[model samples]
Each structure stands twice: as C-alpha cells, then as structure tokens.
Target: EEEKEGLDKEEEAAKSGAADGSGEDGGGGKQEVLDKAKGLNWKTGNPKELKATAAALIEFCKEHNLDIPDDAKQARMNVGRLVLSMKGSSALEIVEEAIKKYGIVAAKAAKAEQREAAAEAMCGHPGNAQLLLAFQELAQLYFKEGNRNAG
Candidate 1:
C-alpha cells in the first residue's frame, strides 16, 4: 500500500510538471530536427548550404545527445564545397572535388581518430555510402563528436 501511494505521488508530480512545462524532455525539438536530418534528400535541395545544415545537425545532436551520422557529415562537406564554389579558392576546391569524387574516412585524423572507428563500425550497412562521405568530411575537418551526456 505504501509503495503504491509513493508511486502515485511520483506520477502526479511528473504529470503536473509536464503540464507546467517543467519536465522538459529536451528531445522534443531535437528529435524533430533529427527526423529531418535522417530524412534529408541528398540529390535535391540544390544550392544546399552545408555549413548551416551541419550546424543544425550539430545542434540537434547536442540537444538529443546523439552521434554524428554520416549524412550530416556529408552536409558539412557539401557546405565546404559550396564555399569553394562561391569563392573559387584552390584549397577548398581540392577538398570539394576530392570528396565528390571519393570520400575518404579518417584519411589523416590524428585527433578525431575515435570518431573514425565509430563511423567505420556504423558503416556496416550498404546504404551508408553517404554516411561514409560525411565521416570523411568530418575527418577532413577534424570535427569532434559533441559531449555524450546521455542520461
């Protein structure tokens, strides 16, 4: 009887807090963005600004405490490509072209080496080509995974 009463009280507290907007799950908004990122079409969305897209992905992962999936990484690289397209910089041009032709994962990542392993493990699926491209972009940029503060 006492345990049931305690459980009821906790449930009420949770419900009330939710009603009052105090039980912020933090994943609601981020989950929506994650869904979007997960479903982003690579072919279309021309003139895609990879930097902004990457930023959005990063924000979503931070809020939801998730890892950088391959597509998001591709978005980042695409951003760099867009920048190169606009400025015609030789340095970025090399990367932009290099990635479109052949995406290299952990090509020379001495800092984010752990991310390479994680991405490789995730590439077990045949559909992870885009993810592979993204991971390579991350390695090229030395992007680090956000803090994994998952509860």
Candidate 2:
C-alpha cells in the first residue's frame, strides 16, 4: 500500500508538471506566453495594444533576468517571427525587443559548440580527445537544432 501511495504521488506530480507545461525543456513561461497569445482577441484589440503586451513581456523578462533555456528561446523566436510576419512593423518591434533582451544568452549557448571544438583541439589524450569530440558533436547538434527551431 505504501509503494502504491508513493507511485500515485509520483504520478500526480508528473501530471501537475505537464499541466503547468514545465516539461523537460523547462519552458513553463514560454507555454504561458503562448497560451496568453492564443487567448487574446487579436481582431477586437487594437494592434498597438497587442504589440505593447509583447513588449511588456520582454521587459519583464529583462528586468527579472530570466535565464531562458535554448529550446524556450527558440520557441519564442519562432513565435516572434510568426507574429512579425503576420502583423508588420509593430509586431516586428516587439520581436526585436525580445531578441535584444534574450539574444545574447542564446548566442552564448550556441557558442558553447565552438568552445567544445576548441577544447577538443587542445586536448592531447586520445581517450579525452574522443570524449571531447563526442561532446563537440553533441554541442553542434544542439546548436543546429536550436537554429532550425528558431527559424
């Protein structure tokens, strides 16, 4: 009975996490943003107001110094691009603000690939070199995945 209770507790926690959209990628905030975006009545609201909301969210993230993960950044960028493409300059400005605030972190994460490659070049031990090469490959894969997802 104790084991069953523990399992039930674990399942409940998993369900809550999923409901909150805090999956393995740690994109709870991004999910919330997407939800809010979906909930907005774009046709009824003034376009400027929508843009202002996006801008405010960007500022909020900056003021909080939120450390967005790579996947979330990519998701946000993709959403921004979509909004910009659909809504013109105002939406683009919001996206630009988001990029300005979060772009550096995302770029640094991508550059980890280069750093791993450099480490691989510097290492002398054959086993270490092999491991570093594997790491470098993994980093490159992540960078490419992020780039693709961002677009």
Candidate 3:
C-alpha cells in the first residue's frame, strides 16, 4: 500500500539521518530508541529487556537535555523492582500483582483533592477551577476508556 511505502521511506530516511548525524537534536536516534521501546516483548515479562529499555529511555532523556517526567521515573523504578523480583512470570501476572499490591487505580481515584488543588492553582477563579477539574476528570475517563488522545 502507499501508506506502507511512505512509512518505509520515512524509516530509511531516519536510518540515514542517524548515520549522517544530520537529524535535528538527534531526532532520528530518538525515533530509533522509541522504536526499540515499542518492540519490547511485554507479554513474556523479560525483565532484562524492560530494564534495558528503561535505562535507554533515561539516558536518552538526559542526552537530549530533557527532564525525566515523574511518571517515567516511577516507571523506571517499577521496572527495576520487577527485574529484581521476577521469577519467570508473564507480564500480565506481574501487572495483576502490582494492581493488588499498589492499588494503582484506587490511588488515582483517591487523588481527587490533589487534582482539585492543581486545577485551582492553574486557575484562580473558583468557578473556572471547578470547570477545569471537571474537564480533567472527563479526560481521565476518556483515557481509561481507551481513547488515549482524548485530552
């Protein structure tokens, strides 16, 4: 298909861009790193691959003069812990265990006050703040419903 050919062309360009060191701000390398992350075998719970991907992401952020977001840092820590404690479990089992141990969804739901505070901090007027909070909650709901780009 034309779309596949277009993608192949873009991939070729990205590869050549890296070889020639012509990508702006190492964009080609960043794309390659992201591709590696996307290629991860998550179903098998390969801790080594997870750790390597995490480390690569951290290093990439550093090298690009970008701050590691809190969520990314937390993910790296989670990967580290998982790597250390894994005993040949599938990623699904690992995730189920994590959900039970950390109550991840419950914790998110319990942070309503924090969201309210943050919304208020970003918007001084109380009515606007409440509106912002409502929008935020709506966006979160959409995201949970599998519309990742809802926000």
Candidate 4:
C-alpha cells in the first residue's frame, strides 16, 4: 500500500511539473524558433519572393534579348549570399543589381567557353600553326586598333 501511494504521488508530481513547464520560461523555445526563422528570412528573403523578383527581371532580360543562364536559381542564391555579405547597401538594390549583372556574367562565361572549345578544336588539327599565327596577328591588330581608339 505504501509503495502504491508513493508511485501515485510521483506520477502526480511529474504531471504537475510538466504542466508548469518544469521551471523553464513559458514560450522560450517557441520564441527562439521564431527568431531563427526570422533570421533566415532576413538572409534568404523567401525563395518565393525571390522567384517573383527574378521572374520580372528575367522577363526584362528576355525583352532586351539577353542570354540568361541555365542555372538561374543557383545564381540568384549565390547573389543572395553576396547581397547578405554587403554592408550599408539596400538588399533590394543589391538583388536588382545582381539580376541585371549575373545574366551578363553567365553570357560572358558561355562566350569564353565557346572560345576555349574553338581553340581546342583548332589545336587538334594537324597543320594549325598557320591558323594560330593568323589568329595571333589578328589579336595584335585588334590590340593596336584598341590602343589607337583609347588614345
């Protein structure tokens, strides 16, 4: 009988402790979770919002006939990281600038890759020295013209 009473009292104490939050502050855990979520929202700013902004920016690029990258979401995420790293700048401005600039960067990288592939293809040919020399001469001529224009 004593053992049964002790067990019942222990159970009641445990229930009461849990009901009273076990001496912990009420809603502390919930508030921490909310703060974490808010920090993440501040940093990444919701992928859906990013999508909306990116869609309009992409449409503008298309209207202007600009080439957009295949991995645009990744680009936006990367630019989001860059924007977060910046100090004293508006996030909207940074994101807008990224939308404007990252596509052109992707286009330039594509052009560079094409040029590298063409160079490799040319180098694979058996008698490409003459072609290379011609390209070198053309590059020198281009530099000369550029320098003249700059002056």
TM-score of each: 0.19, 0.28, 0.28, 0.26
Stretches > 4 Å off in candidate 1: 1-48, 68-151
Q: How close is candidate 3 to the true structure, as a TM-score?
A: 0.28
Query: RMSD of each candidate?
Result: 19.9, 12.9, 15.4, 28.8
The models' CA-based lDDT, in order, is: 0.39, 0.45, 0.47, 0.43
Q: Name the TM-score of candidate 1.
A: 0.19
- Cα misplacement distance, residue 97 of candidate 1 (Å): 22
Model 4, residue 27: displacement in angstroms? 56
Q: Give the clash count for model 3.
A: 0
lDDT of 1 by residue, 101-127 (tens): 322222213213433444445566746
lDDT ranking from best to worst?
3, 2, 4, 1
Better of 3 and 4 by lDDT: 3
Task: Write the residue-wise lDDT of candidate 3 on 1-151 in tens digits.
Answer: 4433543454454344422223344332334434434443443246566676446434544443232334866757864565446545544344333332333222233344444555565665766978865775697689779998885
What is the per-residue lDDT of model 2 for residues 43-102, given as tens digits with 9 covering 90 to 100?
A: 214556555554554454454333444465664564444455545334334433343334
Residue pairs in clash, model 4: none
